[model samples]
Target chain A: MRNLLAAILFACAAWPAQAQLSIEITGAGGQRIAIAVAPLAGEGALLDGANASISAIVRADLERSGLFRGLEVPRLVPQLTEASSVNYAEWRSRLADTLVLGSVAARPDGRFEVRFRLYDVVRQVALGGVAYTLTREQVRATAHRIADYVYEKLTGEKGVFSTRIAYVVKRGERFELQVADADGANEQAMLVSAEPIISPAWSPDGRRLAYVSFQNKKPIVYVQDIEVPKQQIVANFKGSNSAPAWSPDGRRLALVLTRDGNSQIYLINPDGSNLQRLTRSSGIDTEPFFSPDGQWLFFTSDRGGSPQIYRMPAAGGDAQRVTFEGSYNVSPRVSPDGKNLAFIMRDGSRFQAALLDLNTRQVQVLTDSDLDESPSFAPNGRQILLATIIAGRGVLTSVSADGRVKQRLTVSAADVREPAWGPLNK
Target chain B: MRALWIVLIASALAACATTQTPDTQPPAGVEDRAPGATRPAPGTQSVPSTPVTGVDLSAGRPASDAGNPLRDPASILSQRSVYYDFDKYDIGDEFKPVIEAHAKYLREHGVVKMLIQGNTDERGSREYNIALGQRRAEGVKRMLLLLGAREEQVEAVSLGEEKPKETGHDEEAWARNRRSDMLYPGEY
Candidate 1:
């Protein structure tokens, strides 16, 4: 029976020499569908130490999408974290929409091989799989890519599992700009500073980070290379220099400057050469982000007697008010898709996360936490990484793109703030 | 520009409903909606729009439709969610009555521009949350449209977990944090 089953599975793996397999996920009606991923299994190779960790990360990403339910029961039929034997009836009883089973094995030559398949339980058939060769470092990413593919197939939207997040972790009074995997793993301090670090913005290509640091005790804006670990002053104006935002093409930086006395909006080249002031407001003007199309610059201003969101052309034009329903609105981060603007709106006594549509300009409050600030968008613009005060300490938090799945992120013992979530870094 | 100024004033009044909390307050959806009943019937009374005349705020329009302006807006915040679990954008069954009442008022009124700020607790990444918040706001907007809220009158936004009303470090706070708020002209 075992030999016959093995032959059947082997035939299935090579069934069609060039099978054009594709997987698609629909039926999201705002629901987190349950899924079960069996551990990986393959021939002539075996997973060494820590392969289990990689599978766990992939599972966490899917379950956290808040769009898929993952089975994590111990007594559950032995599921492969990669390719596994058939246990269809067991999972079907548990209401699983999809089953992900794959295998990873180590070759004697110190290389790795991976094979995987995604099955739609509702359809009761295979959708997609991969039989490929790779290195150890590439295995986790390949697994993540597979997870992304399966998630997108099921949710009808792109998956952001392969993205990254950049935030400042205060280590013993020193502020460090750190970049890590989207799950806060693989953390590496990108920049270190003695003073406060306010804002961290990402280039469109995820190659560089622009942020405002008080390294010299005075607020200074800097754009640092994410790859080479080099830094340059982007805005070190005479007065206040804070809230650095990168333009879409990564050529310019928009920030809050008080050089003219009262805080106003200013634009500068990434190399810190061309400094052009945008808003001439007598009140406060700060926290500017460019629209995805590079046509408009959205920022916070108090010219209307209270801080609210206003927009102006990137090429210097009269400003148009975008958020008129909130008295205190700041920290405007435009979505990558250019459909909405997320910012801090203080309505009456509520200082919370709120969003505004570009076309309709409607404002909806997204949070109820007190003193929520410094919001950054994910690469897909389907989620946001923000700094919110949790347990009297500033910690990183993430919210789904659709205002579901509020997750409080726990990173270091020190405070974390001003998160700049980059697009998928290749 | 006069018509624009009036509209701006009205919008400003709507915007002014926020901005009066102590900085120490837990940042969440604590927006105090004007009491549902206190708002005078539309068209019966002229709109007391507060234009930016550089005048003292004491002369501003009354900041309440919910009776007492002295009452905290946080006290009136919706204790229940408008969305289903694992769903970022949609009015759940629990909040239907609340949304229905609000929608009923919008149906009676003409094109009144309001911002539906979509929000989520700290869950996913910021960018995705903003989009989710936008989706959540759009979900509410779609519901209102279905219930007679004009499409032109509703705008959507996402503020992914930048604020929260319940500041605890547990599941309950997260629940309160994932929400979308309704914005109006006068009440902050």
Candidate 2:
């Protein structure tokens, strides 16, 4: 099949996902889990766009992680497999409590096994499964690793459904950067540019990605490689190499430079050498962000004269500010259990997507948008993902870290910008 | 770095002595400004102690009849953009004679080489509009190096809010995408 679509474009860095991203989801995440998800049996004899049916992409990745409610598979429940047996009293009398069947076949050395399982059904017991083989361009990464093993075997957390996000879209004056599949489907572009691709980040072993790049006309910082086509540049110095981040031991990066003239916060390394200058503040320290146990960095500063959210000590010195009810906070983002931070506040001229809490400093707000901006969390710190401006274009939303559920995603005419969210593909 | 370029030339000479009456404010948008209206206005307009030479103050042109005064649009060095006010980055005394006619044509063409850029207006956070468009291209490269140009002939970067010119979302396309743009050097 054209050498399997050129080996899925030499193992992922571009393939069928041409604009993709359609999400939508909307609120609802407190008590869902009804489950059901069937249709796997040989996946309608496989091969027609081989992408969508590993139990309909694990029931839309467990109903877009608004915590599962799928349910609707009752044709007297038959094609069950993995040695089918107990109907669990007709899937707990159709209210389902949990079911998830699966099976794809096609293996005579051509690869595509699949499998799935996961039951429980009011305790008819099974809650286990596993299979995969893969090909057919990894059937949506084996249905997001079987919806991250049925969302960590039914919500004990840890399930960013095979993580991967990174955004930026533009379209007209071009842009691009992409990288999808955290339910926005398989998108892939990894750097297209005419100029402008803002702060993308994600490098804690989810492979690579860093970002910034106003082509070479200004904001530099690069770092590619999320499965090949390589990249590099890691900060081109002299005024505006923008907010890059990464440091959770993927060995340094933090960014935002102006080469020593204001937009401060430095750090470097990912091959751009040990630059180090971490915030000197004559004000405007520019979104640094790290704190996932890499000690602390979390940035964005108008040095207290407006743009807030601070933090410091990841080898830097005495800073500590962290958003005080918004005079216009900025993009901070910490959370992957660094206990919440997320940012972008501004509230009256309306910039939205707030969240703070890092141990009771409280905050919350989450999105009533009029222009939010790259918030990004979800490695399992439960949702977040940002980038707003709805009616006038640019989308990609997500929410839930108690801001209920939300979702969005868009991309029919392109605009989406800097999202990030990778790292749990492990 | 030279005390952040002398605190960005004392806040671009205090926002060029309080915006040189750009119609007494109240219009530029982006959080309405007005609080103590940017101080420094005791009499206004004054950073001009010389460097006017080839004269083109708003295009009265005479830089020896502009053979290349930045491709002469009647030459105020063809007024290569300066605008601002709206999360302000200063240099307003009405663009200071087109940045002193391109800082006297880059101090009489000492191997010219400009390139300012800076831009904003797509509202909030693209890395804080890239540090507010590198403080509006380092406040027009510190007013073209305090009007005589050459801190190695200017470089200043930022295209934050990512190159808009006018992709409209109101406030007259964000007042022409908050400004700075200079360019020169085979017009990059």
Candidate 3:
């Protein structure tokens, strides 16, 4: 099996297309921040015919976060810019807690410069403003950055709007690995094949993606850079090779290989050297995940007669079962803070995404859907992106950690699944 | 574009030539009397003699051998799928004869290789299902090894829940999807 023919890899040429996913929110937030995003004065001529306006993108990003409510910002005689003065009394009457003002101007070098400022309506003070000069290809990213700025200033937490997401889209016999914005916009295809592609994972630096592709007639773990054309088959051993997870430092990877009697966790370098088996289970042991602190390894195993999540030292050691309430719980994903574990727990016959509080050992089922799998936490650990079958079609959904706010992402023509939220852009 | 067509056509012709050339002798079938032309048993089990849908055996045997036991709809070797219950990998007693027949065939022919692909229904975690599917295939592989088949001649792998024969979410489709399909050489 190791000496089989190399897979016929196909790189997609069409990318940066329209947003493949349309998001629908179904819940409200507690203590919502009412923010008003006014239209940029000079953006009409520059960003005409674009998919969305700058203000609209920023407002949508903040509203979908489940922590902010977008208030209507009426048109003014003179549109607001970074240098515009805010009428505190008027905004206060409109029930706006905060205001966002911006303007887009054409730079001398043929690029566009976006300047945005945030205002604290309650305090009647002006927050700081920043400017970003970017090419035409970066209009949406600039808007997300401005939203991130406001989110960080108000919520006092890192924003995930500017981060990217990776998912798989299946249309008939074609399978495409796509990268898009966190809001499911700016879709770009990286790899396309006739076989199935699943289990997409992002590197720590957000520069490379490691996923399992079955184009070679069997599952093989392959790592490919986001912008590079070439790819490397990191694990194509004799038996199956799958479930690739990168370490925090990006030096090593924890993957499952079946070369030894059955499925077992193995650690290997990115270049496919220094292979080490970390589990000695007679039963199946797979789906290895690393903690944020890089101290423990959480994986799913059937060693206890049923599939359950287990944790052990990052280096091979004794294992301890983490879930006991439900007979079936798997796909353990540790939060960014290492305080919670997100996995799929079976409720009767329905499978749902659930979160476990590591301190109290309390498990909370996040969704009440049927056949929900692949629970992936946002980089900030606020929301989980999972795949569920809705109306007989595979759709991706984002559910808050508290199970209060929910958003469903669907494509009109294709089936999307296996979502992996990339890390925040540094 | 013309060069690409030439390459496609050349590969197509090469594929035809490879299928026509049956270098290795035909594997031991249910009937051990003939090499290429073998007769099927009259009545093996309660399974219908009709060929199973989606079980394509055209590539497994040479075109000239029309009476191949593996391709005959009435032969026990033609039944390739072993179904299982929910979350279970153990072989049922009803399917033991089918497995025994294949194991006998493998034991007789040393040059023949078999590939067992385990699959599952779409539920729960996909990676865990992959592990479950692997266990299913490994169970069949162990059974074959115990029945006198060489370990080196059998390769067991899991397709997980990726390739489902039936797409419904009901129990009928789930039962059909949770199966291990046995493929002979040149069929995979």
Candidate 4:
């Protein structure tokens, strides 16, 4: 699996202009739907290459989702780029449930006109068709958008292809906070420092990142605008300031501050005003995360003699313990639907990612790694991205919510940690 | 900009140290037989007594006569680190004497200040480890204060798993990493 991922990364770097992430699914939750993506026809050479690149992206996206399987294209079938030209019988005979056909044309204004149609091969009918005008820079994004449409239409759930992921990477003495596509493509480092950087949390709107940096020999929380490169310290108290979690509303941050003599949870505005203490426990209180509805805050505390997850009102009140099975549970993150809680649980001496069904109160460990931490649910809540140690080095791993499918995202010689899946772009 | 201010404050502190006679409170159980045992001159501040027992200071040693106990291997203050159990921050009874020695040293030397940096093994979540490490440091600080160390003499901070005493992943390495190291200013 590692070798295959390395080959894909090498291929991507070999062709930077048309580079796309190649995902290899390590596991599947259940049966996958068979789909066929026909090679698109184009009016010019540029359009033809664009068509093939876009189709590859869409196919990769759908296949990586583990919900669809791409059917092998036969040599006899001619390339079809429109619903009118597609032979539904040919796709149906191949056991494909769905067929995607698209055409690319060069517009006079230098933009590309891309049209695509999704067909239900079983019913022999076109489900939908859409047209998009995009420039060269927007082709990749537009392809992802098209994939999102197809995925949502087929699975009846919102697609997270358009979402971004933020993570921290440490190489030698340099530390960087980076944002990239959910597939680990198009990585861009937003902040770099000689000191360690950890806990990169995204704002709800995906416009900024709040993270902890030790640039000045002490942990300080800083919120940096993702687009503008401007940064301001949101929490730099007298003592350690770390673990910045954004509220669902994006107006306030729930962070861990030791300014009051011990580690405790606090709330501060984005502009660093109106600081309010949330937990007054003598035992360490940290890793405060907000629920989807912005009503309750889930945090980790050691007040019960061991660290466990607890939930309390957002306005600070009595907190109720949530985990009992494990003596060590921390880094609680709620699913998008608020029906599940993902955290790191200690199994024997190894730490693994575990998910708790909020309704049934049943917990299931999702990872097998010996050291897993900082589990963040995807925007769609189908996968949880976490940092785990493999062969003594930190790497990012994404596991299916059901603990079946898993993917390891390695960054060569760098140690990557603290993955924060951003919200959907739209 | 912040570095400049820090330097300014440090120099200001250095200038504020007036060469007055040292405090007259002799070490515990020791008689005032030394030539410097004379009473405090007018307007001079007297040093607080070392309330801790078991120290024989009848040799007429000055309050600061220990000559930086932190560097003396035989001094309890030399044992800078206090270790704890796995995921546990509360200081064990075995480490109490170590804290007491440092507390006594702090009380005797009013000008001495130390930073208690807490650390943890690289097992749990990093941020959570940071908080746990802070509690460990604070646990030592609280013990020192309870044993008569002034509040300003100690500052507690946590390094989480960033600074590991041993890089190994086994219990031996973890045991050493899960500790609070007392560092005099500028030592780090």
The prediction achieving the highest lDDT against the true structure is: 3
Candidate 2 local distance difference test against the native: 0.75
- The reply for model 3, stretches above 4 Å from the true place, is A1-19, B1-65
Candidate 1: stretches off by over 4 Å = A1-30, A42-51, A73-90, A107-109, B1-188
Using TM-score, rank the candidates from best to worst.
3, 4, 1, 2
- lDDT tens per residue, model 2, A1-426: 445444433433332236678887889787998988877777766656535667777788888888888987854445776656756886788798988777788888887787878888887899888887887777777777888888899988888877878788877556678888787776778876556778888888888888878666677888988888578898787667878887888888888787778788888898899898877778678887888888889887876667788888988898988778757788888888888888878766677888878888888787777788878888888888888877778888888978888889888877887788888866
Per-residue CA lDDT of model 4 for A1-426, tens digit only, reads 446444543443232222222335777658888888765566233444435477777888888887889887653345577745666787788899999888888889988888999999998888898899988777678778989999999989888898899888766545668888887778877876656788999999999999988877788999999988777999999989999988998999999898977789999998899999988987889999999999999999888988999999998899999999978999999999999999999977889999999889999988778989999999999989999888988788889888776777878767788899999986
Q: Which has the higher DockQ value, candidate number 3 or candidate number 4? A: 3
Q: For each candidate, what's the DockQ?
A: 0.01, 0.18, 0.31, 0.20
In model 2, how well does chain A match by TM-score?
0.39
lDDT of 3 at A61: 96
TM-scores of all predicted structures: 0.62, 0.36, 0.89, 0.83
The deviation in Å at residue A408 for candidate 2 is 12
lDDT of 2 at B108: 90
Q: Which ten residues in a row have the lowest lDDT in candidate 3 chain A?
A: A2-11
Per-residue lDDT tens digits for candidate 2, residues B23-136, read: 112123334345323322211222232345445343664455457656544445655776665566766675677788788888999897898878888877888887988888
Give lDDT tens digits, candidate 4, residues B1-188: 67766665555444333222222322233223332222122111112333323253424544553555664334556567776667877676666777888888889889989899898989989999888888888889999999998998998988898766566666656666777888886566
> Cα miss at A61, model 3 (Å)?
1.2
Q: Which candidate do you rate higher for DockQ, 2 or 3?
A: 3
Q: Candidate 4: which stretches are off by over 4 Å? A: A1-24, A43-52, A74-78, B1-69, B72-76
Compared with the true structure, what per-residue lDDT tens digits does model 1 show for residues B44-132?
11112333232322344344423432222322222213533332344556566656656776777776566666667654333334434
